[model samples]
Target: MDPIQGKAAGTAPVPLSVLDLVTVGEGRTATQAIRTGVEIAKLAERRGFHRYWVAEHHSMPGVASSSPAVLLAHLAAHTDRIRLGSGGVMLPNHAPLVIAEQFGTLEAMAPGRVDLGLGRAPGTDGATAAALRRSDRLHEGADEFPQQLAELIRFLDDSFPDGHRYARIHAVPGPVQGPAGRPPVWLLGSSGFSARLAGTLGLPFAFAHHFSAQNTIPALDLYRESFRPSAVLDAPYALIGVAALAADDEKEAHRQILSGALSMVRLRTGRPGLVPTPEEAAAHEFTAVERDFVDGWLSNIIAGTADEVRSGLDDLQKRTGADELMITANAHGGEARLRSYELIADAYGLPG
Candidate 1:
């Protein structure tokens, strides 16, 4: 029997994957959090998880995955099998050429194991967005996403039309020009805009269901409705990123998830800071409004014992019809976060 993933493990309901935030806990340093992310990726690969992705968020003390490309390079060195991707990279904050070259380098390192998931949002607030992107393009960021996306694809494939200014430019260390050579591009979205665009382009789409639960179905519907068969895909392929945490003890799982809830509360209230400990979250004072907000957020997260978490994930899959379920478990400590995946993997009977 395999030590990490048992050979007798039961079949899973659907493909299960992971999205690592590289979260910095209240008492942990960023360096430690990053190392923990490496461990998580290695574990995911050993346990037969489909993919391990890192998110990109800046100006937030809790999230340490600020530079996904840099971090993905590190993860690529540590894990051999599991697919490594940005859960995703916010395109507006970067130039098309820069992303193409960066991801192109990643593809060279990991070959077909690399995936480039792109998002249109700046991935941070207005001030940080201004600092990351050009001042002239600030106002037109969202409006310019389609054009920027087109340019990015062109750079990745060296398909820029003749006479174009960038036609002569090429993404160096470029992977082969075929489907398996380059990193597969997946459009990430929390709304219908990217859904429609991704479907129209016949690319895979991943929704931020962990944050935008209400829009999940609508956006997915829009994606399927607008889908047009292209070389990349002949049918709609959708993945949902969900917030879930499974543990040996239900109480412990709830406590860990509460820490994440507190962090989200701080982010929503414009006081973003490191993720608090369970004790700190337990001691937090909440007004009626804040209490309501916490309750609503908690409702979306599937946190409990392994069996309970399995049931919740199964139910969510039935409702969403997601081709893949990418879970993002946010706990105060790295061990707790890693353990959550282990418990969930056992519950789902994932095999190596």
Candidate 2:
């Protein structure tokens, strides 16, 4: 298949909606992290971002966003435009009906702006997963995601389940009148298998490029090459999540990214820290191999000045043919993080 291209212009345009203020913060409150996220979303909208999404993670002290739906609803209530949704909600962790109800209600409250990005992984350790399950529903947690997905879709669609017991059931804000009966849905994955499944099922795809750098390209390729248009999407629509950190200079940007980097390092090494202040990160001794991995990870990351970021984003879009770009900025403090996104918006000609 030929490569997909972005809209070219004589001048640079802020490519896609800017996503901001994600934290994994050093010594910060969950409330503080969430408020910071909301502030970034508001700024992005003012700057002309297209959407704002929150992620879900469980049992991580460094990361506060455990319930994406709850936070998304908070963001939806605050913003008038800019679509609000989950970067992804891990499907394996919750019942399909419950997720449908949560996001379905969100769609009802905010009418035309809700996106449900679903992931199949269990976002936490085995013990947490066990704690989240009900005893009677013990067997229900098995890998029935495909079936669960179908059930969620049916629940969201007022016309689904024709003549069945659930047919009479109504998903309140039932039949949200829009381009489609329900809000748009995208499958989130970091591997080729998911890309193929998403393609076969006829849904848009969003790759977790922020974490799974190795699988990013192959998965996208499979999705695009195998894509067959469905009722909801006429062609393949791809979105990639990239860790974006920007500062006045490359040196400073690199420093800012260390907090998020250390957070990941802790996860990998079983010694997580509060999003480290740059000083703390730079002071820590990293093994030669650890430093090499960090170097590779940083190479995959997009950080530097605005012009640098624009050029990188252009190349990334060209390489992946992604329809949308979700920029996850895990800069240390609230102010700096917001500034990074502001720079991106300014450089790319995104509104703000």
Candidate 3:
């Protein structure tokens, strides 16, 4: 039997959820990028993973998931059992009602298998954030993300007003007398502020551990410490983002990681270029600062063979005790990237 089955393991086990980075790896079109994501989701479902979430990012040439809701809807249609959701929708980018309508529609279609993870950060550059919402409120950080979260819940609650409705502001295709209700609502964050907010509001928390490795432990501690029982969640649900890339050997795994490092380099430098092939990354000469950045970030990543990946996951689980592990593989080479997720699943004794 798996060492860590139903119970939380002292050293975390296999059988974790996979997060698709949707990096456009040597692919001719965006369709290829999303298709790879769907394929990965299908593989994850076959492996009995918990969820398959796609993230939202705008104007990142390497990432194709600018519209997480739409992509999630597509992924849901393709897979039968794996949970589908937004790793997060940057709440400040759009109106809450529109988000409600989109996710409510998704819940109507997928029912119990959808997830709505919301985030307050603007997922793009300052100029792009301005383009997304040109109003002074958005530009000046006037987004009431917490209040909007409540409104979204109200829209999803079929019995929000104790069945005797009040105003004409109900979400169509919402929690009506139907098959069931929407999926669980989770708040995503990399800081203590969002963690505390999620705790106070009684919502599940998913930390951006991949991007904010520095804050992972502290944020989770804050969330769990301040949690209060709510109708939706009696206890805190914590998911941590994990950067992983598994290959046939240690050397190859390190070589494969160049893709992710290159993408990160592009992002931190304000270039936001396309996801490079492993060969391309190998060809480029990284500056000392860029090399340092990649090495520093790589410390948080798990790159090795299947067994090595499993061991790394075990260490992470032991250290943080996350409720779920969300895997992200955006390394170089599209085919290799896809294969990396496969290796992770196999290491965990999952189907691929």
Candidate 4:
């Protein structure tokens, strides 16, 4: 089908990017998922997307990006120009020093192309969160996320407080020495706490509108209101992450996104599994309650033909005043997913 066209007439041209979960589709292996992620990153670069980020999710049958740092290294090696990083690394899951070192290594390898977006959530179920932390205490680590973020920044900047124990220990391959010293840090959030913190720290912020559509604007508002100028940013910089699935038409787009919609339903219903195909989703029997639940979950998604999706995105950008927009499109097959992005890129007039 021919791609639809649209122009953001009144607003400035905003950068487009991608956030991938490395989703494993029905009848697909994790290896295939990772490979497809690499393929998509390459395509995104060719299509002029500004950055490509992988999310961290543990113990999920559907997501292969349990280790975003490792996966980012692979993606960085495979693609030349597109910036690669974690959509975010869940800060509470590991030690601050460890994360600093891992991302520091990534910067050493790819240099100016690495970004570090941090999140406080566990990124998994309660049991898995506990296991990842190697402690039965689940909530404690999350509560310490702010402190962890500070320490991570200090490590990356080689500026730990003199009295701090870690002050003497340098995060090896420490801060890059040129124009882009440390990997740019971004705070990822779905709520107000993270928004305020990111703003207070003067870091770039990314709000997850895909799942937390209700909180998107509020969080961004809080971020901007609380923002303070720092070395990293003189003004508040924000990006909104949205679920955007594009196809030949509205019906085709809706059909293609059924896999993701059904996956969300299964996840919320305590039966989280691999992403089901459109056929599988179509075949599943939904009770009235289930139908309602699925509809509510997918209400945030912007799915349609290229022009329709572009219009939705333009409205979102105008409403939020976001500096950039990151799209996440999940489909049952790699080709369909790629096509969705291609159509959106074409509609947005992203440079090749």
Predictions in order: lDDT? 0.88, 0.75, 0.79, 0.85
Ranking by TM-score: 1, 4, 3, 2
Local lDDT at 217 for model 3: 95
Q: Please provide TM-scores, in order, for all candidate models, with all chains considered together.
A: 0.95, 0.90, 0.92, 0.94
- Per-residue lDDT for 1-352 in model 3, tens only? 2111222222336347777768886544688887878888887777667778888899988889999988988887898877788888888887777888898889888877788888888888888888888754564453488777777777767445644343457666775556566767889999997899888877888898888999999999999998998876778778888998888898998887887788889899888887877788888899999999989988989888988988998889779988778888767556777788777766665643
Winning candidate number (lDDT): 1
lDDT winner, 3 or 4: 4
Q: Pick the candidate with the highest TM-score.
A: 1
lDDT over C-alpha atoms for residue 323 of model 2: 78
Distance from true position, residue 130, model 2, in Å?
2.3
lDDT of 2 by residue, 106-195 (tens): 878787778888887767666676676634443455467777788788877765646787777666655634433356777888888668
The Cα RMSD in angstroms, rounded to one decimal, for candidate 3 relative to the true structure is 3.5
- For residue 333, model 3's alpha carbon misses the true position, in angstroms, by 2.9
Q: Which residue runs does candidate 4 get wrong by more than 4 Å?
A: 1-12, 176-180
Q: Backbone clashes per model, in order?
A: 0, 5, 1, 0
- Order the candidates by lDDT, highest first: 1, 4, 3, 2
